[model samples]
Target: MFNKILVGIDRSLISKKVFEVALSFATATGANLMLVQVLSDREEDYPQLPAYSYYPMWDDQTVRIYQQQWEEYKKQGIEILNNLAQQATEAGIATEFTQMSGSPERSICQIAYTWNADLIIVGNRGLTGIKEMVLGSVSNYVTHHAPCSVLIVRDTELLPPQSTSE
Candidate 1:
């Protein structure tokens, strides 16, 4: 029943499974697929600051360097999205893509709303407890906030072991 499907993608292990599921849906239903990748700048990705009490502002040169780095990061994200788009296209599915810079959860939900997507497909990292609290779960946020229906693909290997009756 889905006409427009938006898939949130990234360069993560779980993304492979997400793509497979989304692609299957798109191929089966002949739905238009839109793949989106958000280029986030997590604090852990940057270098740590020194032990100085007062933090100095970035100099003009430093600003330029950071800008250049962000540009490269965006380019890399575009490349990844393009590759995914190609795969979808090869499967005879109509596909488009976008690369955004922001929080993954917000970006994915915003795009799904703006694009009028009928469904959003995202991968859940299966983080729980303290880890989920600290890192925040993008799929969880999208499930709660997305305007349209959301499908969270969880990696089977990450799922907890099931109990078998004797």
Candidate 2:
């Protein structure tokens, strides 16, 4: 009975699983799916300066580099979201893709709540304990903070490999 479903995707191996599971569920329920990707603002990464610096002239070069990096990140993030939207369309599901600049978990949760999603699907670290902890799993955060129900699709749990012995 999910009317609005939100799936959080990132450039990771687990994202494919998230996409599949979210798409299937949305299809089954005849729900509208929203794919959200976050691109952090580059300016946030650098320290803020209270006063303008002109003597050393280091600020201009630093700002230029940051701008370039941010542009690249934004471009890549948009391409990814566009592809995801296309894939969902190919699956005959209603979809919308968005690229926002903010914390990943915060952006996802905000969108889910704003859209009033019945369920939010995300990917786990594919049965890896150490990696999950070290990377600070986004799915874990979304599951805990989302306003609605959350489904975590672990890559390893999705489809087990066929027996080689056969």
Candidate 3:
């Protein structure tokens, strides 16, 4: 039985499924749950704000606007984690949540190791081919590099079509 379970969550819809599975497992096994949310400045992630560039070519107003939006994104991320943590805590489970900024793939594994987790749970984005290569799969990376056992949860809607043989 796992004593410490670390769950990697994001703002994506599939994260709900991941957290649900993790919470169920933790409750069943009486394991403490740690929720980790990694935020990235990837343009696609914060499409509401103008993309920040490596080189500076923005007016003061644009920079200020981008900074404000970035702060709001971080606040939202923490709020999500807080609410999820409260849910598990209310269920009488020892739960802790964290918010970090960096590469999701690396951050997830790092937290798993630092927390000495017995199992790491994460969601699969179902990315494939060019999309996977370009975006890089966080679940794939965690599956390979996690310090402990890794559980990858895939959303039902993203499952591959099944073939039937008569």
Candidate 4:
């Protein structure tokens, strides 16, 4: 039985599924859950311009707009963590969460280590070969670097209907 479980979350289509899996485990094991979301700058949909130096090359108006959007992005991340943590708490599970900005791979592992988690539950986008090399996989990194056990949840929708779910 894991005493503490760390979960890495993002704004992926599989996020809800990943949360469901982690929540079930926490409920069953009575484990304290640490949910984390890393606000990656390399968003596939929304592009976050560099936030340093006030984007000196750009005009003040553009810099302000980007800064505001970035702030909103961070806020959304915190909201996601808060919502998940609230769900876990409602289930009587001791829960905590953090929203960080940086490399998702490293951030998840760093939190897992510092929180002394017994298990890490993360989602796999199943990127492979060239795509994996270019995009880098967070689950892959976390599985190899986590301080304790790692549970990777693949997107079940990507699997055959007859296959095991979650």
Candidate number of the best TM-score:
3
User: Which lDDT values do the candidates have, in the order given?
Assistant: 0.86, 0.79, 0.87, 0.85
Better of 2 and 4 by TM-score: 4
Better of 1 and 3 by lDDT: 3
Model 2, runs deviating above 4 Å: 40-59, 126-135, 157-166
lDDT of 2 at 42: 26
* lDDT at position 107, candidate 1: 94
Best by lDDT: 3
Please rank every candidate by TM-score, starting with the best: 3, 4, 1, 2
Q: Candidate 1 at 5: error in angstroms?
A: 0.2
Number of clashes in model 4? Answer: 0
Q: Candidate 1, residues 1-166: lDDT per residue as tens digits?
A: 9999999988778988898999999988999999998876442343223334234665666666667777776787788889889999999999999877779999999999999999999998888899899879999999999999999999888899999999
What TM-score does structure 2 among the candidates reach? 0.75
Cα lDDT over the full model 3: 0.87
lDDT of 3 by residue, 32-124 (tens): 999998887542566354556434667788778778888888898889999999999998899998988889989989988999999999998
User: What shift in Å separates residue 16 of candidate 1 from its native position after superposition?
Assistant: 1.6
Q: Candidate 2 has which clashing residue pairs, if any?
A: none
Clashes of each: 0, 0, 0, 0
Candidate 1: the clashing residue pairs are: none
lDDT of each residue in 1-166, candidate 2, tens digit only: 8999999877777888788888899889888889988764322333333355455765777777657876777788789888988988888889998887668878899999988999999876554467556656677789889999999887764456868873
Positional deviation of residue 134's Cα in model 2 after best superposition, in angstroms: 6.1
lDDT for residue 50 in candidate 2, whole number 0-100: 30
